[model samples]
Target: MFDFDEMESQNLFLYLSLLVLSITFFFQNIKPRLGRFFQPSLETRAKAAILSRQEVAQFLDSPIVKEQEQEQEEGISPSSTFDFDPYMETKVELVNKALDEAIPVGEPLKIHEAMRYAVLAAGKRVRPILCLASCELVGGEENAAMPAACAVEMIHTMSLIKDDLPCMDNDDLRRGKPTTHKVYGEGVAILSGGALLSLAFEHMTTAEVSSEKMVWAVRELARSIGTRGLVAGQAKDISSEGLDLDEVGLEHLEFIHVHKTAVLLETAAVLGAIIGGGSNEEVERVRKFARCIGLLFQVVDDILDETKSSEELGKTAGKDQLVGKLTYPKLMGLEKSKEFVKRLTKDACEHLQGFSKEKVAPLVALTNFIANRNR
Candidate 1:
């Protein structure tokens, strides 16, 4: 008496029970292992925590955090801590000396003196240093890019002079000193600006790089200050001034900054890369990085203008408000503007990936310095 049906039922039950046990074992043991395998390590979590802030503060206060978080997330660690202050000091000295040599008190001493006054003033020298740093980042020597570096600074000084004219923003102070038009008559200041613009191209041609690279650098520099770049931004800015925010919105404001501010920064980096012999891809990468920081620079400027004192800013603080101009803080609120700063800083640093940490230190440090600068 085989009891065939009962025997079949018993086998089916046994099979079901074993399958259930396997699943339970997987959930209890193997699943835990799998979860642990997928989870990020404590070190990774700690690194990520660098970007977290419990309280909303000005973005400049935590410049190191944004840069460090970006680097650590990419598993990048410099061999040693990068001392940015000394690095900036060295670069500033180099640029200042070059600029002094570039513009001597020659014939027509008034224009040259005005040019020298504006160019040799105590600027952050952000544009020129960016050129040098970018050149070095692409394996070019500093000396090779020195000419272009000085050229970029000259263009920047020209813009500042023109920007402070009675027809423009009409500011009385710049770089902690009287505006160019204030010290020198507006006519002479205007002439000095024109002279610098011409000298910038001439100085750029003096670079010992190939003619092709020199041509490319010259084209980029011209476009930056032309109708396509700074001029475009300034034109829009002047047109939109005192208009209702609804009429001139964030998009409009961004257009102004992208041209008026970021264009030259983009040019500075692109010129450096070209002179440094970087490939097209590397040049574009640096361009993108500079664009982010360029816009970031304006956003930070807006924040500083709203919050810092005139003495603290080295320029007229609250001038944007005084002039009925739109700013990031006015449009996005201070907290949101700060958040934008963080985002821009993050984006800026991310572009530096794939380059050696040591080689890219100057640019990275520059980004942080720009982010955290008090003046």
Candidate 2:
């Protein structure tokens, strides 16, 4: 009571010192715990952002993002920068040249001419490209699978020739030109198809691969084109003609497409992987990938036929609808068919996981090409 002001000042200094000590202690010890408690950790933050830390890392490390970044640095359009077009063009030219060399204008002019015309037409060469891509996906050179690729293409061309005959789809146009039957009468067309079919096996034998792999590939191709494969699908398609959706449902339609289209594609990829010396697991994985792509190709074909004109498709469009073919569009709505395409594309890409990103790029691009192709 006698020294009230001095006592009050002492008390204030004491309180200030206590407060400073408490703040320093909190900063030194409690701040980290509080920050961790209040703020999410990196993994937790990744989870909050709808991705795992691993997924985030993968996204950061993906080749596509890196490629896009590189392209941007080079002042190129990221949307169109992949160079897949040039890659495909180069492969197509290689396959085309090999095909020309394989089937020269030799004796038996009419049949040879028909085979060359059908095989050498302006086609997309998707099967051969798939074959070559699969070969490369398994640490093999593209040239190693050239013979097998050419054989697959020859078989594909044979199918097209047969499919366009008067006894089948009876189409007058193919690959933006006259159908094989239209250009060279049905009799010659049929003979040429048979010749190509035989030649495919013969040409495949020329591949400088192991005899075991060659035998496996040959058996696969034969099975794919036989009653269990394309023939089965074509038979179902022909039988289901003019039938209502109730009569032949999506299952039947899938059977047809799987056999008619997917089987050959599956064989092509499997052959490439086999001939390329890929392990059994790799070959099977490639088989699954190609199967999805094969179905996707047909689904897109159906959608294009329904939506685009012949000029756009470079073939007879709307023919499936006219014939009441059990197409994806015919059974399911267009939107659903498109959704199916997305699912197939995703599934196809999923099978390519174990392969190197750089090696698998062409196959991945080819998958997208088939899905998005207008023709």
Candidate 3:
């Protein structure tokens, strides 16, 4: 009379159905909706629509969007809205002043100029600002972060110089100007990058930060830029060329990017925390935040390469595809890649929720900006 077998089968079927329904619901929510006999139930459709509307509303309410609207009202483009000119102007002035003092007069004028050129080049010093912002978020002084910020910038510049070399990306232009190699000779370019790398350590070692903190910072920086970090990623990236990458292959690409691009950025955030005298736990949390933002940054960069012009992006567009390098857009398709970016941005922002909103505003704004940047 109990019909126990029947009951068990019924429960199993229910669970399986729920699982299928959930999968369907997830796809329907992320993908474009189409009216079909297989369409979700009315309640599911309504929920999906509501979720979509909420996401749109969130995008509209984002500070980046608000700023974009304000700029547009004043006849400025959205891309130009996040103007780095003022920030760059200050950073350049400070960096150049420091370089002048650091480099003795008549000391290999070309090397000095090349160092200055690589450091003072026009780009949004986003990574350095990220370092400062992370420090501030943990109640650290911006002045305390200056040396770390400069070191972060120097490492970043060194990476770029190396990336643009003929052995790597062979990029001819950066920041809308001729690349370091093009402006300077190939040998000089290589030396400039090497000098920048050395100077990053020099700055860190000589900075007034505590000896213990300096050791940690130096070790982390070395780890990030060495085999376990950017160089390893670059090696994998080079190996990926002309290969038909599956999902696993794509993951390798992601790993490569996480190291090649994200590690330095994440390290910057962690270093800021270290310099701020933050606890290890706090530094790791910032590292998580950086990982999310870094991946999102690369995803957005890939998307922009597919959809934007070189003129707008300030470098070669579609080079990833041209070189057969795996990318989010390549593996996930443009629409899904965009959805992935959105998810990553949301996750990145969620990580910052524990921090003060004021101190975290730039980080939040930056994730959104990276997710949506067309160029």
Taking all chains together, each candidate's TM-score versus the true structure is 0.80, 0.78, 0.73
lDDT of 2 by residue, 156-187 (tens): 99999988888899899999899988888989
Off by over 4 Å in 1: 1-72, 75-79
Each candidate's clash count: 0, 0, 0
What is the C-alpha lDDT profile of model 1 across 1-375, one tens digit per residue?
Answer: 899899999999999999999999999878845642443332232223233323334543554432333333362333368888898999999999999999999989899999999999999999999999999999999999999999999999999999999888999999999999999899999999999999999988988998767766776787678776788878888887788766755556777887888878878988899899898779878987888899889999999999999999889999899988878888777877877787778778878888878888888778878888887
Question: How high a TM-score does candidate 1 get?
Answer: 0.80
Candidate 3 lDDT over 224-329, as tens digits, reads 8877778877898898777675434445666778877888888888888888877766776787788778878888888898998889988887778887888877
Q: Pick the winner on lDDT between candidates 1 and 3.
A: 1
Least well predicted 10-residue stretch by lDDT in candidate 2: 69-78
Model 2: residues >4 Å from true position, as ranges? 1-82
The CA lDDT of each predicted structure is 0.82, 0.81, 0.71
State the displacement of the C-alpha of residue 335, model 3, in Å, after optimal TM-score superposition. Answer: 0.9
Cα RMSD of all models vs. native, in order, equals: 16.4, 20.5, 16.0
Instruction: Report the lDDT of model 3 for residue 81.
Output: 41
